[model samples]
Target: MSKPAAVAQAAAPAAPAFDVARVRADFPILSRQIHGKPLVYLDSAASSQRPLPVLRAVEHYETALHANVHRGVHSLSQWATEAYEHAREIVRRFLNARSTREIVFVRGTTEAINLVANSWGRDRLSAGDEILITHLEHHANIVPWQMVCAATGARLRAAPVRPNGELDLEAFRALLHPRTRLVAVAHVSNALGTILPVQEIVRLAHARGVPVLLDGAQAIAHEAVDVQALDCDFYAFSGHKVYAPTGIGVLYGRESLLDAMPPWQGGGDMILSVGIDSSTYNELPWKFEAGTPNISGAVGLGAALEYVEALGRRAIGAHEHSLLEVATERLAALPRLRLVGTAPAKAAVISFTIDGVHPHDIGTILDSEGVAIRTGHHCAMPIMELYGLAATARASFACYNSLEDIDRLLEGLRKVRELFA
Candidate 1:
């Protein structure tokens, strides 16, 4: 994604007017002080602070609807099953997926990718087959395929990212060959904040008859994702990144593809019937969702999606973009400070480094100031190596973040520079 030329020419547009103070009030943690200073949370890309609605939803489910699903005839069991399935429906609507059957709830993005790699890649890919991916992928996307390749005798190939942190489309096109079995890449670069051109990537891969999977952990909250619109075969995202509980995430697969793939795991819910000789698997999603699922986490995720919809995704994006613009200008003006990712278009993440200051030191000093930011490789070590950096201090934004948060971050960075100098 590239910044619009209009924004570069004129004053960056003001974020659409909203009652941000009221929004802030919904998150109780935001009100607390850290180190005797108001917490300036800018690490949302790592995990967003859950609001009242999500917290309440989880509480309600635990208190009132606590029973094993799809097992018993009791009222509590029936009610719990309804709540659990209803959460699946919410996930289906959230992604604009064609059917609820397409949504598979897992522990998080990492588990979801591993599920695909084990269930789909391991069975289908053979010797000499290639699994195409991008250099911008998170470790969750990378290691799973590597594991599958080693098991299946398939090769793993990565497309290059340009110096500006954008994917090299031509290189990606060239990499898609006759032996390519799958194309898995990040919807947005987790470390660099570069929103990858997923639509184009999908188009190119589809033209070559290869299915595409997107690691959408970073894009789910910041971008409007319609699986039907994107036409990707699979999309994976973590609930925590989108203001939900930590243990829940989603894998949205095309119903046809999911139906064809074997169950990733075998356990209680995933079986239609179990015999000593052979076991029958359940239908589409439940097959992949073996054992006891994260029932409360799914409830919280549904509530979080509802909360985000009520706030309006477009409005939240605009506000974050405004914050990004302001932070970029301020950080650029500071001497000896270098921005790592400068893609033309980006989400609200900013990765930067100051001369003579280690990123860990930057994070520690920011913590002392009650300003939270992520430091180190951020689970994308390949990206760190790409830019010739060991690590970078990353400040990421979310709906609850305000311009004042950026101010505090800058103040902390200045202190870090002075201390180092």
Candidate 2:
């Protein structure tokens, strides 16, 4: 779903300041214990846990309004249709899009990116054309463009990233030349939590006549996004990453661009009329949506967005920033521990490694202590190789996380270090 333009940036108003304890109460999973210890969940970058509101929303829709939408005239169908379409409006409002037509629902960010590659890339890209991405991109953002480029004989170029895990903007700008057709980048690095200079990236790409697509899976839960303000051609994100269920996501495209692009997949809901000779596709969003969509998932996603909005985006940002600061400092103070991705501006994620322990081992010990964290290349092997590492222990935060969570993480890390020692 889309957001209001007002809360899209770092400097948005922080009124009704975030209340962490109050917010934590809304998420029931936080109360669960692991290994006889209170659960310290810090894997939100992979998937955020759902709150009561989202869960209830999904349950309500499935229980009462479980019917196929847009084709039926019965009461149940009409109710289902309203819930689904209202979800579209929620997305449009969440992203500050001009209309609901620009918001196309897909399975998740991966599918959204693939949709653009298959539809837009296939239609517009040709031999010798170039698609530029960054070294810090998640594989979801990288592989689809690679497949599209390989199919079209278009070249793929990766913009350099600095030693500190920040994008080399100078190198990125230099790579945009006559042959560059698309510039795709992540708004927030999933591996490092580094927020990219997307506004500048958009401006530079547009100056070079290249359209931009932002992978915002890691950005949406932590901050507000306005498609118009960024002026990006497309923005994609996953519902699970933002506290909704899996198998639901959004792709926001400029109305003109989407209108001109052909449907990536053809099915019943996407066609206006089908004939033995020829077929006419449905309008903007449904044309892209294709089949019977994820009705309940959309309803849950709408409720999730509303939940975030009521909490205040600016306040959430501030709260998470504080957690990151504390977590970074405490982790840095640990003996023989190295922190990765120390960008000045970041979301609430920390990837690190202990001197004598494998990241997997670290994750294992942490889990034993009821401190859940992620460990791997994080689907960002390119960035991992760039850092000359195999993997890192990643602790990513959400609205439900707290300073005490970081404390448990640190305590768990100390155990890992002691074990290795």
Candidate 3:
């Protein structure tokens, strides 16, 4: 079940893209049963199951080469450090970032955002300066800005979206002014499936001389992200969401921007020389990393990324699109069912509310039926309020999921409807 990690390190095999039958073989847990029914993991938007290669890589490191990275002058440190840095290269390639130096590993997306807000936002923001974000942001994107505003006397404005869950570009344009310092937004919404026009948004933001930080937690895995192409100043995502381990994520920042931001935390490896009065910092990414980084986690992340790269993003996306289309059609056919996000384009996420059923109630029933899905505002409350609901049930698909999983989800929905009726 492990990814051909050694093979992945070498040239990729000439494999057909979008081979779901073969792709399913990599994820070991996809074969399990729950509640007398086969497990159908339709929640990759929250977290993806690890492939055999990724699992094996993690085990290989822990068993043979487990050690603290970046400090020891020993052979184990060199091995672990190489693994960790190689993992960064894998991530850099995954995002098409310019350099591995631009990829700073943090615990996950939340820490990545805080690094920017506290380190960059705090230093740059001033009283009456405006920070723009969208209604579709996850709470991680929202709360950090709120703190920045409170600390610096800057103002936070939410760019409104339409009822169809599309961003109101006009509303966003109107909010932009001379004082706008930073524009933070989600590349793809977690609760709703709307894919924001981040490239266009970035273009606009850059035109105004404002830098944009994209909350790429949901978007990075579902779509091919090119930080250089999108020209987003910063793009952040969690490895756990991309079939890697928890406590590992990346912050892909523009080299110049990263060079300017100070370290949010003052600790071990982040510093060069410390004196009674002052201290100097390390270069580029290490300055921000600050502590003994997640070596094994990073190695696992690299392996997961290798699996993804070998699988081919274009084919993976096409397969996901088919699954999403089928699920959307099936769910939309139900009476009393209202989809929360109906953008012209979306990732593998589908959010909806059934009349007279709280999303949590629906989720509970589905879980009992051995179906897993997400419920609640999905940590993006402003858009939930905009839709006039407290929460929605979200069924997300990953590469390993089959059409049969969607059918099971539909069956569970019908049963819920019957109970209500």
- Candidate 3, residues 48-76: lDDT per residue as tens digits? 89888899999999988878888899999
**What's the residue-level lDDT of 307 in candidate 3?**
83
Model 2 misplaced regions, further than 4 Å? 1-17
Global lDDT for candidate 3? 0.88
Worst 10 residues of 2 by lDDT: 1-10
Query: Which lDDT value does model 3 have at 158?
Result: 92
Give the per-residue Cα lDDT of candidate 2 at 417. Answer: 72
After the best TM-score superposition of candidate 3, give how far the Cα of residue 36 lies from its true spot, in angstroms: 2.1
Deviation in angstroms for 73 in model 1? 0.9
| Model 1 TM | 0.96
Over 1-421, each residue of candidate 1 has an lDDT whose tens digit, in order, gives: 1111111123445544655676788788999999999999999999999888888888989999889999989988898899999999999998999999999999999999999999999889999999999987899999999999999999999999999999999999999999999999999888989999999999999999999999999999999999999999999999999999999999999999999999988889999999999999998889988998999999999998888887878878887898899999999999999999899979999999988899999999999999999999999998899989989999999988888898898999889988998
Instruction: Give residue 264's lDDT in candidate 2 (0 to 100).
Output: 96
